[model samples]
Target: MRHDSATLIILLAVVALIAWFAPDVVLIVFAGCLLAVALRAPGVPLARRLGIAEHWGVMIVALVALVALGLLVWFGFATLADQAREFSRAVPRVLERAGTLLEGLPGGDWLKGQAQPEAVQPSARAAANFALAGVSGTLGALGNALLVLLLGLYIGADPTLYRRGALALLSPGLRPRGEATLNAMAHSLRGWLLGQMFGMAFTGVFTFLGLWALGVPLAALLAILTAIFGFMPYIGPVIGAVPAVLIAASHDTSLVPWVIALFFASQNIEGNFLTPMVQKQSSDVPPALLLGAQALFGTGLGFLGILLAAPIAAAGMAALRVSYVEGWVEDPADTDEKRIIRPA
Candidate 1:
């Protein structure tokens, strides 16, 4: 028992060391795993229906997705770029207006003092760069993207090979439990991804129509931002609404409320209707828990972590349920027989 405890401690220390030193690589690999599951989720069923091999199905789906995304970027890139530039130009003026408004309010002086920008120290700059390394527009980001794509393709093609290899690391008696835990984790991730994808689509479409109807400037850009931020769950929608609100306020104060209402309604629809319906396959992981994980992972692992946090939290919940709750915490007599999830 002491030996086992020591071994576990050593293993944990090693993992921590690796995480601390190679967080970007770790996150990229993690991204690949989630992408594999997401791609395979629809691929397998489609493959069976069309009498095609699983790998071929996955390749087709992935290629189609890539082609669609490429086309979107190809067509929308100019408009997105223009909107981005316009937003950048508008931000300072908006901030100045906000600053003016704050100056007229109580505690205005204190707020202004607090908001003043200080020169970034060298260490702080380094830390900032490290945090942003995953999307730094450097070779690192490209390399990570390529790595994830290759890993996803290989893993999605024949996930069982990787699964068997992972299971082989455990003792013969523990292999079954390990396999079960991994399967549960994958299912949880797949469900979470599906739900999130649907949520993003719904948020984007709703936001676009509402903003366009309201004659908001850069409606498409804001809608895309809304969709991208949807991945971050609770806080994301709020952050996404900021630019729209600022731009609207710049135009007309009356438009500000309309923008706010638009976002509020969109979020309501997503949180109340879209998420619950899609997340039926995903077991409940508390909202508070997910938010906490997002905070922690974002702090530790940066943007990629924030993007993937919901699924990560879902997988964590599944692991805890399978390994700790069912395996040891609950009485076996009271527990229902759990079925192992198999690859399709």
Candidate 2:
């Protein structure tokens, strides 16, 4: 109906407005939705096992999950702290060597005279500030973290409420189809998240092992960083590897090729083998479409926009397929039983 189409457009407009006007809050909501779904998978059986009320089970499960996450964060921070200390000790020597090497180049004398001293000072100060900012930005992230945790807790307690609430907004007769559509959406999202998580973990492990074999320092920190990047759709592997390669390059030029090969190889394995095997829930969307969505979302919103764009678009697609194409204009020749996903 025209009314439903208008409503869909309005809903999308509202979502886009929120994303544009309040990206940080939108990010928290996105993270909350994902974390809630993650907890939902393990919450059901445990709830029944403990004979607790569903809400109480949510609290317990959420508590356990949050605690586990806190520990992981602590461990990762500890590793990063160690790496930072090592960097503080080693960076000066690395820079000095780099300067020496630069000074020894064939055109070094000419380049040195051409290099402006004031420009170098600002660049050095900017680099120092950037490093400090990396460790000092926790206060800003805390609010986002709390928002995600609270939202996850509330949603995990009553995910059905959200599904039903959303379905209720559809036309009365379309509610059943909406439910099925949402299930498909949930399946796709959960499967994608699971696949990415597994792939990221495997990539991180691969990074750590390879770096260790090549005598790279801060391998643990680098591995964790790689895992974070690998979760991102397109640009993650390259972003994660840049610093790793830079650090290795600083130590020894010969290590550059080895590090590059290892990083690319691990990601290739994940992309070719692990991802398809695990992420079988959602059929692959066209890469061009995916890239376009990412570009549009990134341009319209920000980093998290790029992150959630694909799934949000997929959910929209699923809903439209069910409501308009499949559910609305039923084929007259089809019997009720034969209708299924085709047309009724």
For this target, which candidate reaches the highest lDDT against the unseen true structure? 1
In the predicted model 2, the residue pairs found to clash are: none
For candidate 1, the lDDT comes to 0.82
- Give candidate 1 regions above 4 Å deviation: 1-17, 106-138, 331-335
- My TM-score estimates for the predictions, one after another, are 0.87, 0.78
Q: What lDDT would each prediction earn against the true structure?
A: 0.82, 0.73
lDDT value, candidate 2, whole model:
0.73
Candidate number with greatest TM-score: 1
lDDT of 1 by residue, 89-116 (tens): 7765666555555786899877755543
Cα lDDT tens digits for candidate 2, 1-344 = 67767766777698789867887777677779777767776676678889986767778788887799899878777778979799667655555445545687898766554443432444778888987886677766776778888898888788888877887777665566667667766666667777788899899999999999999888888898889877666667888998787678678879989999998899889977897688774535555776788788788777777777766665556655555566667652352533333210
After aligning candidate 1 to the native by TM-score, how far in Å is the CA of 216 from where it should be?
1.3
